[model samples]
Target: MNHAPASVWKNPVHFLAFGLGSGAVPKAPGTFGTLAAIPFFLLMQPLAWHWYALILVLSFVVGIYLCGKTSEDMGVHDHGGIVWDEFVGYWITMFFAPAGWLWICIGFVLFRFFDIIKPWPIGWVDKQVHGGLGIMLDDVLAGFMALACLQLLAYFF
Candidate 1:
């Protein structure tokens, strides 16, 4: 995807107020888009989980509106490029845990697993939900499921 623009017509940071513009990646956008949020999560690693969780909750609420609006502006439905949901969702799974590389990798694997598998309730939410909230909800739930599994693994090993 083309790099976000620099001037007024360019970067959504220039165009939109929040991170809405980052969701505009042109190809495998969601994945690349999600990559953008990694630094942020890494930075927040030292913060307490409750604080991080609050921020995430806020993001989830605001994300729906921004994601939906961005989708409309981009004229696409759940475009692969728009992956702020994945960023937040992945972080959700990593909550209350160490942010070391191995843990991060595990979180990523678990997140991808639940996100892709979309088993049971995750699948149900994905199908039933609509618009921006719908788009983000499935992922958040996936994150939760992933977190559960990861925690279980950590417990046994």
Candidate 2:
């Protein structure tokens, strides 16, 4: 639980990588980061799928740099406070999500579960990768897992 100092927040990379300070929370920063993503997901829900995908891709690309720089500054690898990955991950999980709070809640739960549990390939990636890409990859895979589950649920019911 690396609590980055106030000075670290001065860096734009740190600020954004920290999920606009939601990651600064002493407990469950990743959870808070995912929660912070919900409103953005709601706001972007209306965009065409391609546009939404574009933004999600852009976010992931930028997150690689932002997370890496912030991690360097903090002197910790994938510090808990660096949660931009969570923000992007949750957004990915919610892509094409069915309309309703129930689905939203489901996405959130599934993402967090996969993220925290890091089952199979997600766990494999977390161990085999390093640096900024490493920080983001596990969550990205978690998002994919959640998205798959959400889509399947929507299809079934």
Candidate 3:
């Protein structure tokens, strides 16, 4: 585990990218980062879909810079400690999901599964891409895949 210095948290970019310090938990940081996003997801759940989408887009755009900058500071590309991508990715996964804790838990599990498994292009991009874009893109794909599954489940059952 390539842990960032304590002072790294002083930087707002690092703080956010690290999922408000959840990424520093020393065990399953990505999982913890995704967990940290749940409250924010709930807060956004009541918004109009357009507003929710706008927020997701903005988060992704900002995350590119935030993740990149933090990675640079830590001198590790896509370091495990940089998990703002996971937060936004999980949020994206839950988009249009049905109400209730059951849906939320399902979305969470789907997002984590795709993210950790990194199938096909997700795995490819993770290996080939570089910098902030790389840090966020793979997770974005994972979220999209999970969202598709969630939406399908909602439609069928």
Model 1 residue 52 CA deviation (Å) reads 0.8
Report lDDT (Cα) of residue 22, candidate 1: 55
Clashing pairs in 3: none
lDDT of 1 at 50: 84
Give TM per candidate: 0.81, 0.97, 0.97
RMSD of each: 3.5, 1.0, 0.9
* Candidate 1: worst-modelled 10 consecutive residues by lDDT: 11-20
Model 1 lDDT per residue over 1-157, tens place: 4443333146452233123455455555555545566777898778977889888999898778766775666565555555768878888888876647888788787888888789989999888987788878998999899889889877886
The whole-model C-alpha lDDT of candidate 2 against the native structure comes to 0.92
- If the candidates were sorted by their lDDT against the true structure, best first, what order would they fall in? 3, 2, 1
Q: Tell me which of candidates 1 and 3 scores higher on TM-score.
A: 3
**Model 1 regions lying over 4 Å from their true place:** 1-27
Candidate 2 structure, TM-score to reference: 0.97
Ranking by TM-score: 3, 2, 1
